[model samples]
Target: MGGIVPMRDAGRTGTLPATSDELSRLLTVVRRGRVLTVTGRFREPRSRLVREIARRLSSNFCDGAAVVAIGRPFGVRELTAALGCVPGMPFLPYGTADAVSWLAERDMLLVLDGAEHLAPEALAWLRRLLTAAPGLRILASGRSPLAFEGERVHRL
Candidate 1:
């Protein structure tokens, strides 16, 4: 709702981004319309990178940002709530569409931590989210890439 995500934990130091070159590249891509997926076997690298990126860019960007850690098995509804976009009505409880509608046209960065364990169905729904939210930028951390169209998968 504000300049920075209210959920950002400034204290936590997870796995950091690879280097300045990669970090700079990632930042540049997210600023544009590109979806950057920071791939890794563990969640720490992706989580740490998101935190560092947020801390650095929160001072500059007027857009919004939210990071959610999906450490284990979770479904569509849990995924939406995990991202802090709880469905307001009974018609769309835990629906990815609800989350996209909640996002509307706002420019924001969403970090999905521990995405490796997401079910195939959940991953498909996530692709829908990407398509629905044009201004939405995702930085996903997973053992394997989501493999959605236009997804820029960077293995760590």
Candidate 2:
């Protein structure tokens, strides 16, 4: 949609090419839900497709969109670092509280691409983020769902 967004690669997996119908469905779900997972094996085109969706729909969000490429061994630290990269966020020290506070006031689309594997603590962190940031919407691409209270999964 724009310039190449830098991506962090997880271990390689097959590509699942995206179709316009799939894109439309995903977009619809994102608009209605707080969190969505495009579930597929690692290294598929899920991240690319999610980024495209973010680009297309970011304008609907007040603070716009940020796509974070989640790499292997995903954890709270990585999550915090990724969130810090969102435009205008202060330089955040590695901590969950900082992230939660910062995002609490913003409206944005946060796309976590390549989140196929998340440890329990990381999941907890995401839960806290969702609970605190009322205006934040997450579109994640992974092999499995985050299983939050209102998560919507689109299996690829």
Name the best candidate (by TM-score).
2
- TM-score of each prediction: 0.76, 0.81
Query: On residues 70-91, what C-alpha lDDT tens digit does candidate 2 reach at each position?
Result: 6666678767776666655466
lDDT of 1 by residue, 1-156 (tens): 111134446436544657889888877766764466777766566667766765565544335556666666877767766665422222334566666786655566676666776778778877877777776777766778778777787777
Candidate lDDT (C-alpha), each: 0.64, 0.74
Q: After superposing candidate 1, which stretches have Cα over 4 Å from the reference?
A: 1-17, 58-63, 85-96
lDDT of 2: 0.74
Stretch of 10 with least lDDT, candidate 1: 85-94
Clashes of each: 0, 0
